[model samples]
Each structure stands twice: as C-alpha cells, then as structure tokens.
Target: MNAIQALTYANIAIWLGIGAYCFFLAKKQSEMDRRLNSLILQSKTENDA
Candidate 1:
C-alpha cells in the first residue's frame, strides 16, 4: 500500500482504540455509580432502624 493508505489505516486504528477505551471507562463509571447508590440506600436503611 502507499503512504496515504498507511496513514489512513493508522488513523483508523488510533480512533478505534480511543473509542474502545472510552466505552470501557464509561461502563466502569456507571457500575461504580450503581454500587455507590446501593451503598447509600443500605446505610440509610440501617440508620432508620
């Protein structure tokens, strides 16, 4: 392949990697938020009792 084709491929790979990283990070943050919310509710229940 030519230089331009190679460059385009490199750019595509970089963007793909970035997208995967962002998606994983977003999933992790959502999981953490859910866990935190559950913990808060549990604490509140304990306090009520």
Candidate 2:
C-alpha cells in the first residue's frame, strides 16, 4: 500500500481507539453516579431514623 493509504488506516484506527476509550470512561462515570446517588439516599434515611 501507498503512504496515503497507510496513513488513512492509521488515522481510522486511532479514532476508533479513542472512541472506545471514551465509551469505557462514560460507563465508569455512570457506575460512579449510581453509587453516589444510593449513598446519598442511604444517608438521608439514616438521618431520618
């Protein structure tokens, strides 16, 4: 393959890698948010008792 074709494939691979990383980070953040919300609710309930 020519240089341009190699570069194009490399660019696409880099973008796909970045997209996968972002998706992983988003899933982690969502899990953390759910845990935090449950903790807040638990604390509120404890204080009321």
Candidate 3:
C-alpha cells in the first residue's frame, strides 16, 4: 500500500480504539454512580431507623 493509504488506515484504527475506550469508561462510570447512589440511600435509611 502507498503511504497515504497506510496513514489513512492508521488514523481510522486509532479513532476506533479511542471510541471504544470512551464507551468502556462511560459504562464503568454509570455503574459506579448507581452503586454510590444506592449506598447513600442505604445510609439515609439506617439513620432514619
């Protein structure tokens, strides 16, 4: 392949990798947020009791 074609493919691959990483991070963050919210509610309930 020519230099231009190789560079184009490399750029596309890099962007795809970045997008996948961002998606993974977003999923983890949402999971952590849910866990934190549940813990906060549990604490509040215990204090009320």
Best by TM-score: 1
* Model 2, span 15-38: residue lDDT tens: 999999999999999999999999
TM-score order of candidates, best first?
A: 1, 2, 3
Between which residue pairs do clashes occur in model 1? none
* Model 3, span 1-49: residue lDDT tens: 9999999999999999999999999999999999999999999999999
Model 3 TM-score, all chains together: 0.78
Q: For every model shown, what is its TM-score relative to the native structure?
A: 0.84, 0.81, 0.78
For model 3, name the residue pairs that clash: none
Off by over 4 Å in 3: 1-4
RMSD (Cα, Å) of model 2: 1.4
lDDT of 1 at 7: 100
- Could you give the C-alpha RMSD of every candidate to the true structure, in order shown? 1.1, 1.4, 1.5
Q: Candidate 2, 17: how far from true, in Å?
A: 0.3
**How does model 2 score by TM-score?**
0.81
Give the Cα error of residue 46 in candidate 2, in Å.
0.6
